[model samples]
Target: MCVADGGVKTDRLSPAMVDKLTFLRGVGKQFWDLTDARIVNRNITMLRLGTLLLLCGSVFANELTINKIEDAAKAGQFTNIKIGNIQVPAGQTLHLKGLKAGTKIDFVGKVTFGFKQWEGPLIKIEGKGITVTGSPGHVIDCDGKRWWDGKGGNGGTTKPKFFAARLTDSSISNLNVKNLPVHGFSINSCQKLAITGVNIDVSSGDYANGAHNTDGFDVGSSSDIQIKNCNVKNQDDCLAINSGKNILFQGNTCSGGHGISIGSVGARKDNVVQGVIIKDNVVMKSTNGIRVKTVLNAVGSVSDVTFENIKLVDISKVGITVQGNYLNGGPKGEPTGGVPIRDLTIKNVYGNVLPKGTNILVWVKNASNWKFAFRTLWEVKDKIWRRTIKQDSDAQWRGPGQCFADHPQPRATRFTFP
Candidate 1:
C-alpha cells in the first residue's frame, strides 16, 4: 500500500473506509471498558484491534517502490521512491532526469551496469531539490574489466565514463561505486550540492596498471558544493576542481591515485576556480599529494584557495606542486604567466614522502600574497622546496606558531626543464 498526493489505494479497503475507522474507534472504547469486567475477553479483543490498526496505518504510508529503471523514468514526481535492485543492460544508460522538488530516492540493493566499449556515461542524474541515498552496502558495479586493456580513456578500447550529475540544491550520499572504466563522477553546473560518504574502489586496476584516467570526482561549473567523508582508490585525481566557487572538500581519504587537485584550469577564458577550502584530508601512496596546475597558453585565474590540516603519507612524487606551464597531462611548456595565482594559503600541511620524493615544487610565472606555514615537519629525501624564478614575490613563509622563518632550501638539480 502506497500513498501519493491523490489518495490511498488499497485492495482490502472499501468505499466506506472512513465509516469503518469510526466504528473501530467505538469498539476500542468498549474493549477498554470491558477490561474491568472480563479481563481475558478484553485482552483478546484488544490484540485483534491492534492488528487491524497497524494494517490501516500501512495503507497511508508514503513510499513507492520501483523495480526497473524505466519505471523510475516514468514515475510522476513522487516525494519518496525506493529503487529496487536491477541490472542495467549493456549499450544502454540508466538516467533519472527532471525529478521534482523534495523528492527522496532510496537505494536498497546493488545496481550492476553491463560492460560496453563506447564513449558513454553509464549513469546520469539531473534534477533540483532532490536527494539520492543508499543503504550501508549498496553498490554500483561498472564491470570495467571488459574494457580494461592497460590504457584507459587515453587509448585502447573506448570505455564509458561512470556517472554524470547535473543538479541544483541536491545531494547524493552513502553509495559505493566500483570498477569504473574511465573517470568516476562528473559533476557539472550544480549549485548547493552536497556529496558525502561515497566510496570509489578501482583498486583492481593497479594490477599491471590497467586503469589510466579513472578520476574520482571531476567538478566543473558548480558553486556552493561540499564533498566530504569520501574514500577513493583510483588511478587519477581523487577530486579535481575545474571551475567553481565556494567549494569545500573535507575529511576525505585517498590512496593509489593522484591526490586532491585544482585544475588543469585555464583551458578557456571563463574557466576559473576560486574560494575553495580543502581541509582535514588524507592522501597515501599517490602520485602527487596536492597540486594546482594551470595551462601555459590559456587565460584565467585561481585565487583565494586554502589547504589546511592535510596529511600526506608516502607520496610517490612531489608532495605540493603549483605550476603554470601545464600541458598534455604534464608540466612541459614555457610558462607564459597568462594565468595568475593569488591569495593562496597553506596551513598545517604535514606529510612524509618516499625516497627521492620532492617536497615543494613551484614554477609559477606570476603569484602573490601567498602564505606557507610548513614548519620543519614535512619529511622528504630530496629537496625541501624549489622555485624556478629567483627573488621574493610578495609571498611569506611562517613557522608553526606564525613566526617568520627563513626560506626553504633549493634542490641540488632541477628535475624538469622547459
Candidate 2:
C-alpha cells in the first residue's frame, strides 16, 4: 500500500522528463514573446495540472501480493490480490474483512495455519460484492491431524473452526480444503451468497481417535443462499442448517459421515429453517442419508422444506429420518410438540438402505401437511419388497406448541409410494 510521504517531492526528476519540461517551458516563453503574456500563463498552468495528476496516480498500487501474514492487511488496499503460500500466526486470523466492493482475491499455493488450541475461524471474509476464489491445485491444508482426538468441540484440545464467511451478494467458488479441523464453512448472517465447487476431504479422520463434529457447511441466520457442486467426506453432517430461509443445496456429494441434515434446531438465536430445497444430490457410504432432527423441548418451527430427486447408496442407518425428540445423549423417548414441523414434502427419493437400517422413519409431534412420493428400493432374501403406506390423521397432537391452524387440524398424514 503506497501513500503520501509528506508531499510529492519532485526535487529529482529523470533526465528525459527534465528535458521535456524544459522544452515545454521554452516553447511557452517563445509564444509569450509573440503573443499575449496571459495566454502563456494559462498554458503553463495546464501543464502543471497534468504533471500533478500523473504524480498522484503513482501513489496507489491497485494490485498486491504478499507471502507473510502480517502483510496480509495490505491486501485491502488493492482491487486485485494474489495470496501465496503463507502460514498464519497462531491465535491470529488472516483478516480479509470489509474490503472494497468488487475486489478479487485469489488464493495461490498452500495456506496453512499455526497449531494452537483456540476457537478460530482461521479465515474470515465479510463484505458485499467481493469475489473469493482459488487457483487450480491450490490447497488449504488445515493439517487437522494435529488436533483430531475424536472429541471435536467436546473435550480434547480446543480446535478452531475453519471459515466464517459472512458475505452478501457475493460468490465463492473452487476452494479445495483438506483435513478440516472442525466445522468447515460457517455461512452465517449472509444474504444472496453463492458457494459452489468447494471440495472438502476430511476422511483421514475416519481412523480411530480421529476427527468428530466436522460439519461440511453449517448455515445460520442467512437467506437466499445457494451451495452447489460441493463434495464433502467427513465425520458429521455434510450440510446442517440451524437457521436460514430460501436456501438451496444442490448437485452435491456426501460420504463417510452423517448425511445431509436440517438442524437440531431450537436453542439458537434463530431456530427456524424455512423454504429449504435439497435437490438432486447423492449420499453414499454414509451413516444416515437425509434427516431432520429438532431438539426436544425447544421452541422453534421447521416449515416448508422439500427433499427431491435424491439418490442414496449403502446408507447404514435410516434412509430418511425426521424426529422431534433429538437430544444430546439420545432421543428423549417421545416426540415433543414444541418444535412443530409443517408443509414437508419428500418426492422421488430412490435408494437402498442395508437390512440393518430402516427405510423411512418419522416420529414427530405436531407435524402436518406432509406429502411423500417415493421410488425407493430395498432388497431382502434376494427379493425386492415395496410397500405404500399412507396413514391419515390417526391422532393429531395439538398440544400447546402446535402450529395453530385456522380451522380443524389440517390432515396430518404421511404418503409413500410403492
Candidate 3:
C-alpha cells in the first residue's frame, strides 16, 4: 500500500497487501509508488528501483491482468503481479514465493504447464528483494512436448524441473523460455542474482523426442551471480556452474548445448567453485567449448576460474574441455586431482572444432594457472604465426604456438587459437 503524496503508506504492507490496496483504482491521482515515483511515460522500465513495476492506474489501467492462479504462491499478497493466460497444474508449481521486499512480478500473458509425471519445479521462485519479469510479447511455454520422452533428467519419463530459482536480492528479466522438460534455470540459493534478457528456447528439443537433460543455466549455491544477455538453445549444459562464487557468465549466446560449464564438481554441499567469470560468450553448434568438469573420485576445489572472450562456432565435441575425470556417465580414465584446479583461466578462446573436434582438452590433475591460461600474447608476425599454428595438422604439438593435439590423456593438451 504505497500512494505517497497526501496518503496511503500501510507500514510496509501485508494485511493481505493491505486489503489489496483498498482496490486502488484511483485512475489518476498520479501517486504511483515504488520509490522515487514520477511517471507519465507508458513504456515503463525502472529495472532496479522497484524493478519492472506496472501498477496501473491510468494509461488505460496500464496492466493488472492475473487470470486465476490459485494465489500464485501467494506472492506476499501482491505489490504488482500481472500474468494473464495461465495454465499451470499437472504436478503443479508456479509458486512465486514470499515476495514483498520490493516485489514486482510481470509476465504479460501465455504461460502453461499441465503435463504430469511429477518431480517438477515447473516454476518455483523464492524471494527476498524480488523482481521477476517478462512482458513484451511474453511466452513462458514449458509445454515441453508433454514430457519429451528422449529421457531427460536421466530417465524415461519422469521429466519435470523447468525453473526453480530460489533467489535473494533478486532480479530476473525478459524471460522467454520454451520447450524444456528437464532443466532450464535452476539457479539455486542465490544471493544478489541478476539475470538479463533470458531466452532459453530448446529449439523444439532439436527433433525426434530430443532435448535430453535440457539444462541451460543450472547454477548452484549461487553467490553474487550475474548471468547476462542470455540466449540458449539447449541439449545440456549451456552454462552450468554447479557451485558458485562471484559468478558472472556474460554476454551469452550458446547453441545446441554442453558449452559453458564448470564442475561436474563432485557431489554437493557447496563443492567449492570460487569466483568464476566466463565472459564475452558465443558458442555455436556446441558440444563443448570451454568446459570444466571436475568430479571422479569426488572431493572439492576449483578456484578463481575465468574463460574470457569466448566465441567458438561449429564446435562438435571439444574446443577446450578441461576435465578432472567426471565419472560413470562419461570421462573416467585416471584423473585424481580430486578437484584441485586453482587459479584457472583460459583466455581469448577463439573458434572452430569438429574435425573430430579436439583442440585443447586438458585432462586435469592439479591444474594451477593451467599453462598460464594458454599464454595469449599475440603480436602476430612470425609468418602469421606459422600459418595460424599449422591449421591443426594433427597437432603433435609443443607450445608458444606449434600447438594442439596428441595428448591422448594424462594432462591432456590440445590447442588451437585464432
Candidate 4:
C-alpha cells in the first residue's frame, strides 16, 4: 500500500486479502499501544482502501505492478511509473526521444554506468526545462575502478562522463553519483541551470591507484548558472568552470581535489568565462582554495569575479590566485597578454596551508587597475599589479607559515596590475 498526501492506493485483497488483513491486524494488535495513532489510522485506511479497490474491480490490483521507465520513455508517455531494474550496457544508449516539455521522471533503481570506448554520459537530458531528481539509494554508479589508473578523463580507455545536461532552464538535484571513470558532471550550453544537493563520491580511488584528473564537476559555456550546496570528493578540481557568465558557486564542501577553479579557459574553440561568484564554501585538504586559470596563449578575458567567506583546512598549495598564464610557477609570471583578466575581488576569505608553502596571495597581469577590496572595486587600472597582505615578515616570504608565522587573523588584500 502507498499512501501519499492522504490518498491511499493499495493492492486489493480478496479472501486472500481478508486473510492477510486478519493476519496483519493480529500482528498490529501486539504493537498497537506502542505505535503512533496516525500510523495505525493510516494502516486502517490502507485496509479500507484495499477492501474498496477489491470490490471495485480486479483490474485495480494489476495497476500496482512495476514497469520499465524506458518503455514509457520509448513511447514518450509520462506516467507515474516505477522501474525495478534497467540496464543500458555498453554500445547502447537510452534515448528519450521528443521529450515532453514538463515531464517528471523518477528512477527508483540503479542507473548503471556503461563502460565504453568513447565518453559515457550514462544519462543525457536533451530537452528544455526538465527536472531529474534522485531519491535515497538511487545511484548513477560508474564502475570507475575498471578505469581508475589515475589518468582520469584526460586519457585512458575511454572513461565515461557520469551525467550530462544540456540546453536551458533545468533543475537537477538530490542525486548521488559515484566512481566516475573520468569527469563526473558536465553542464553544456545551459542557461539558468541550478544543480543543488548533489553528492559526488569519488574519494575511493584517490589513493587506490593514483587518481589523476577525476574532477567532480566541470561547467562549460553556460550563462547564469549556479551550483551550490553540493559535496564533491575527487582528485581534480571539485568544480572547474571552463567557460560561463554570472556563474555562482556557494555552500559546497570540496575535499581531496584541485579545489575550485575557473578556466583552463580558452581551451574551447570559441568560449569565454566572466562574472563568477564563489562564496560561502568549504575546502578540505585540497590542492588550492580558490583559483582562476587560463592558458598562456589563449585569447579571452575573465573579469568581475569575487570569492568570499571561504574556509580552507590543510590546503596544500596557494590560497587564492588569478593567473592568465598557468604554465608559469606563479601568477606573477610574464604575461603574454593572451587572455586579460580584470575586476577581481577576494573578500573575507581565510585559509591555512599544510606546511609546504602558500604561494602568492593574488597575482594578475595584462590588466589595468585591479582591486581586491572587500566592498567593491572603485577604480580600474591598466598594465601594472600590486599585492598587499596584512604582514609579511620576510621579503622572500620563504614558504607560507614559515614567513607569516603569527598572522592568524583574516585580512583583505587588493591587486592592481598594469
* Top-lDDT structure, candidate number: 2
Would you estimate the TM-scores of all the predictions? 0.78, 0.77, 0.33, 0.74
What CA RMSD would you report for each candidate? 9.6, 11.7, 17.2, 9.2
Worst 10 residues of 3 by lDDT: 379-388
Model 1: what TM-score? 0.78
**lDDT by residue for model 1 over 1-418, one digit each (tens)?**
2112124344454323444455555555565576665456866767756755665565434456667667767544566666668888787778777677887777766788776678889888788998988865567888787888878888899999988889899999988899889999999899999999999999988878488789999999999999999999999999999899999999999999999999988886458999999999999999888998888888888899999888988887777888777886677644666777877888877666565566666766667667676332322112122252112232333222221124443333122111
> Which of the numbered candidates is closest to the native, going by highest TM-score?
1
Model 3 alpha-carbon drift over 4 Å, by segment: 1-63, 66-81, 87-105, 108-110, 113-139, 146-171, 174-209, 212-233, 236-256, 261-286, 289-316, 319-371, 374-418
What lDDT score belongs to each candidate, Candidate 1 first? 0.76, 0.78, 0.72, 0.65
Per-residue lDDT over 204-293 for candidate 3, one digit per residue giving the tens place of the 0 to 100 score: 778776768788888888799998998989888888887878998899899987788897888778888899888899988877787788
Off-target runs (Cα >4 Å) in candidate 2 are 1-60, 374-418
Query: What lDDT is obtained when candidate 3 is compared to the true structure?
Result: 0.72
lDDT of 2: 0.78
lDDT of 2 by residue, 1-418 (tens): 0122234344464332344455545544454466555565767667655654454354224766657887777766787776778888888888886588998777876899999999998999888898888877679989999999989878899999999998999999999999988999999999999999999999999999899999999999999999999999999999999999999999999999999999988887899999999999999889888988889889999999999988888787667888787886445656666788877888877677665565666667767777676332211222111221222222223332323222232232222333
Give model 3's TM-score versus the native structure: 0.33
Give candidate 4 regions above 4 Å deviation. 1-75, 79-84, 327-333, 359-363, 374-418
> How do all the candidates rank in terms of TM-score, highest first?
1, 2, 4, 3
How far out, in Å, is residue 254 in model 1? 0.5
